[model samples]
Target chain A: MKFNHRHVLSMEQFSAADIHAVLDTAENFLELNSREIKKVPTLRGRAVINFFFEPSTRTRTSFEIAGKRLSADMLNLSGSSSSVVKGESLVDTALTLRSMNPDIVVVRHSHAGAPHLMARHVGAHVINAGDGQHQHPTQGLLDLMTVRQRFGQIEGLKVAIVGDILHSRVARSDLIGFQKCGAEVWLCGPPTLLPPEFARFGARMTYNLEEALTGAHVIILLRVQAERMNSAFFPTAREYSQRYGLNSEKLKWARKDAVVMHPGPMNRGVEIDPSVADGAHSLILRQVENGVSVRAALMMMLLGGGDRPRGDA
Target chain B: MSAGVREPVQVMNRRDFGRALDRLAHEIVERNQGVENLALIGIRTGGAFLAERLQKQIGKIEGVKPLLGIIDITLYRDDFANGLSNPVMGPTEIDFSLAGKKVVLVDDVLFTGRTVRAAMDALMDHGRPTRVQLVVMCDRGHRELPIQPDYTGIVAQTTRSENVKVRMKELGEEDGVWIEPPRPRTLPVAVLPPPAKERSKRKK
Candidate 1:
């Protein structure tokens, strides 16, 4: 099948086959990463723009590494720029960036669906790094790649996502992505942080973290948005951690082999204790490593080149 | 009536394919002078199988195997953008370096030499080989580049209007070469020429 879309705007844009293709491609890139030179000229001389309208360290750095590894001319644009600070519209920003002739644009914006709008107006392939609380596709995919790598298969696995669901773009993307891959999903947190409508996407919702962790194959802890603490979403950080925090004792309820995952900037004492975060179950760093491979795969797929790295390049 | 179409006709069967590979192995060793510093790299899919078969033959004769690599030149092709709308990526599995070794590049057919050109380009990326030799199962005429096979099993003469296909036993049951008829052109029928019978009648 044709790689159905050019712009990777959301996890919703991916079908099961699309996910499979991404996984398969990511595997090749992982193999490539073992080489001594560890570089491919597939995107050599092509221009790439990391147009992040939101602040990020990992996603932006991972994308920069991925593009640079492919030898693409990469430029990073964060929200702190003078033009963006002067309040130029997203359309104007995208048009100005497009004028510089980027072959691909990785956009992370505060407003949701910003990448989709930029894709419609520009000629470059737009990869949504993250958009508000809507989606973070690459993170969802890297999580999937890491899980699939550990379990040998995604289908029939039970994945439990604990911590904030209402405010998490990661949670939303993962719920849809895991369901699409045939994994059962459970969302656990306080009712204020857990959306009932998330069950509409096939994830079972519960308030009790222990109930969610029971018999699960993978447990993902999302970092609590501390900014939301001021908004009365929860009574306090101590209460939230005491109720939903993943400590070693609570982790025992999960299968012994259950993978503990967190899309990080970890809150050591809040959503997860330091012992659990640093324990054997943690896939935090593997997720970061897979992050580069998965992004490389996505960029390569978007460029539509096969295994043949450019000869002259 | 024979007017409608012409089908693919098999030229060399599976047994002949084996014999050809067996002979090509001897040729490769003879040219390179006893496989010293020799390595074999196959162009993916068809050539990979051929490379392995050659390895087995070389092992049987020389009592050792040359280093083996398989290259998939999809990304290296010149028409990477315009030619393939959705290309399925395969891995380039050259684990060892080509520092100063004599490399033999293998493929099923030598047609336009584009595949070989791409393979050479891909090999240079791994590191410069001291020498590179081309080994093809079939050398069908209609060259678009100045590339000729160092060792060829069969020379199947063909025109630009025809297509040549090479199949291996590893891929399926039958192993042979087939030539396909040309596709019909899309030019308007109004630009006319008299039929032979009509020309004879006019002459009479």
Candidate 2:
């Protein structure tokens, strides 16, 4: 289907076929990766804007790379670098950018569904990079794509997503994507972080790190938000790590070929042990690399071009 | 018989068609000297099946299995919203490592180059490959994007009013290529205005 001029707001809208389509396109993209000229003029005249309210080096760069590779003109506007510090409201900033007549906007905001709100005001297609703790759909998709690449499929694989769950948008999006792909999901964190009603999504909740890690084909380590400590949610980083950290010994309980993953920037010794992060089983870097491919695929599909014909709105 | 109706016709037979795949496979190996750092990724359905066959043929000639992957390219397609209902997703399989490897994009046909364009966008999610080359079973003439196939099994010159169909034995009963005329475009229904008396009564 034609993906041109579409807004990607959440994983809730994705179907199994949509997931398969993106993965299939990404495969063809891998084939195109060998040329000396790593760019195509598909979106040459199109303008894309990257509006990041939150601090992110990896996601922002991945979106920028995807735009540039497609030969689209990309503009990066971070809160610190933009007019937001100069007293520009989110809506005002969105309006100002909308006046520029961009073809697509990739937005990462501190508030949940900010991209959705921005979509209402702008004529360009909106991509939700991350909004508060609401959702990071692209990250979730890339994570799923990475897992699928390694495992050949996502059906019935036991996945343990450990660490901060309550305040993590990545966790929320990951849960949806993993479940949609037919994997059995488990949410493990401190009781305070793990919500009581997570069973609604068919995920098993746990406080014991050992039990959670056992027999899991994939172990997703979420970075513990240090700011959560200020609220007295957890006593200290060291204490939390001792109880929940994914150390080499703890990883032993997981499947032998279990792939370790984390959304960066990693806290090294906080959420996950250093040995495990750097271990042979770690697919952390692969996840980052896949982020670009997945984002590029998303941009292309959402922007325009695919198997299906463009619809008349 | 309607004034605008036309019949579809067979284009290429099995013997001539097998030669095309064989030639394309030879060209791929000749260009790369082997399939060592290269990968073959096909679009879903037909392209994917073709990629698997090419991998087998290339393996026989070069003694190496080129890394194979299948892309659904649906969510990434530009016209995703045109359908009446939400599209169903399919399996995307790429088992080998994509890091720093040369990739060969395989497809059953190359028409407007839009599919290849979408494929490129999807490829970035996996990893950065060292290089990428386009390989198609049929390069039907109709250039919408600035894309050219590096290796083509058959370069068929056809009009925009004609459709090219490549059927593989794995997915279909017959392994052959067919050319068919395009279906007639339907006109949209025009909305009629309300009656003058009813419009005036509403205003009053």
TM, every model: 0.88, 0.72
TM-score of chain B of each: 0.84, 0.84
Candidate 2 Cα misplacement greater than 4 A, ranges? A1-5, A31-34, A305-313, B1-5, B10-181, B187-204
What does candidate 1's lDDT look like per residue over A165-281, in tens digits?
Answer: 988999989988999999999999999988888877877989988889999999999999879877788999999989999999999999999999999989899999999989999
Task: Please give the DockQ score of every candidate, comma-separated.
Answer: 0.21, 0.11
Report the Cα lDDT for residue B37, model 2. Answer: 85
Best by lDDT: 1
Q: In model 2 chain B, where is the ten-residue run with the lowest total lDDT? A: B80-89
lDDT of 1 by residue, B1-204 (tens): 233227876778888888988899999998888877899999998899889889989989899888899987765676654436666767878888898999999998899999899899878878889999999998987788999999998998677777778887788757788778887778766767778899899998
Each prediction's Cα lDDT score?
A: 0.86, 0.81
User: Where is model 1 chain A poorest over a 10-residue stretch in terms of lDDT?
Assistant: A304-313
Q: For model 2, how does the per-residue alpha-carbon lDDT over B29-142 read when each residue is reduced to its tens digit?
A: 898888888899988877898889889989989888888998766545665534323344465677666779888888898999988998887777667888889988888878
Worst 10 residues of 2 chain A by lDDT: A304-313
Q: Candidate 1: where is the Cα deviation over 4 Å?
A: A229-231, A305-313, B1-5, B35-37, B183-204
